[model samples]
Target: MKHKQAGLSLIGLLIVAVLLAFVFLIGMRTVPVVTEYFAVKKIIHAIAASNPSMDETTADIRRDFDKRASAEYVDSVTGQDLAVYKHGGQFEIGIEYSRKIPIVANVSLLLEFQTDAKSNGGR
Candidate 1:
């Protein structure tokens, strides 16, 4: 009679461990960037929502965005980077930015983020 053992070999286990480690490392690098993106999006949405009357000037909007972005520790995209315009009687605010995260020697991950929100619609 022959019996077969079903389990991961040592080499297979090591390979799995290495792959998991790499995945974890990439995830760790990615989380903060994503967090910041969401924070920026929230800030823009809040600003737009609060000024639904569309009475605020573009300069005023930019200034408000700068203040809130600073508070949120979002330095990648500034108020100057925003695209502010009026459409359908609503203020539309948007931002596009790219972030580069270095993962290893001479290797990096680049991420692009864009968000647009209207004053009346909550996102």
Candidate 2:
């Protein structure tokens, strides 16, 4: 007669638990940045959908971005930081920014995010 084993041993379970904990720790540090990007992207989409005139100047765009950024809680970039230009009667708004996520003492992760929005009329 042979007895069969169907469960993970102590060492195997320990390894699995450690791996899960590591993943969770990293996710906790990184999830917020991803969510913030979505918020900024939403604001961009909103502005694009509103059909802002191409004649608006950089200051005008920055002012509008400030209002929307405050409402959306987007602190990463402002209109002044964005690269705004017009191409074929379509406004292009773009930003390149980076986020620092701290995991442990002197250990951190740097993430770069870039997003853009274009006027609907141009499309």
Candidate 3:
């Protein structure tokens, strides 16, 4: 009777351990995806603020900013082109980042995450 009880308890412990391991693996896989999404969003916001006027020809300013921001980015999965333009009094900026998930040695999950932000240049 004691032996039967000990066997059941050990099996229960093993099941719980396996479940925890599975959850840990999933969390690890998802962390990079969430991180890249937010990083890209931050870059978009910075670009929008830096380019106040579409006609201002702010490439030098934007290039410097992109250099700093892109350093935080790993690599692009889709659009590498960053664009800035103006619509009347508002400034528009576009940023895109590519994200890749490794599923196999030769296959990957590729996605392009893009964001646009507009501002009217104010306090």
The prediction achieving the highest TM-score against the true structure is 1
Rank list by lDDT: 1, 2, 3
| Structure candidate 3, residue pairs in collision | 77-98
For every model in order, what is the number of clashing pairs?
A: 0, 0, 1
Q: Which prediction has more favorable lDDT, 1 or 3?
A: 1
Residue 11: error of model 3 in Å?
2.4
Q: How far is candidate 1 from the true structure (C-alpha RMSD, Å)?
A: 2.8
Global lDDT for candidate 3?
Answer: 0.64
TM-scores for every candidate against the unseen true structure: 0.88, 0.84, 0.60
* RMSD of candidates 1 onward, in order: 2.8, 2.4, 4.5
lDDT of 1: 0.89
Model 3 poorest 10 in a row by lDDT: 74-83
lDDT of 2 by residue, 1-123 (tens): 999979999999999999999899999888888888888888877777776786777678778888999988887788788787877777878788999988889999999988888876543
Model 3: per-residue lDDT, tens digit, 1-123? Answer: 355433457788999998899678666776788776777677667766654554555474366446756687734432336666666776676776666677547866666677878866632
| Ranking 2 against 3 by lDDT, winner | 2
Instruction: Return the TM-score for candidate 1, rounded to 2 decimals.
Output: 0.88
Candidate 2 colliding pairs: none
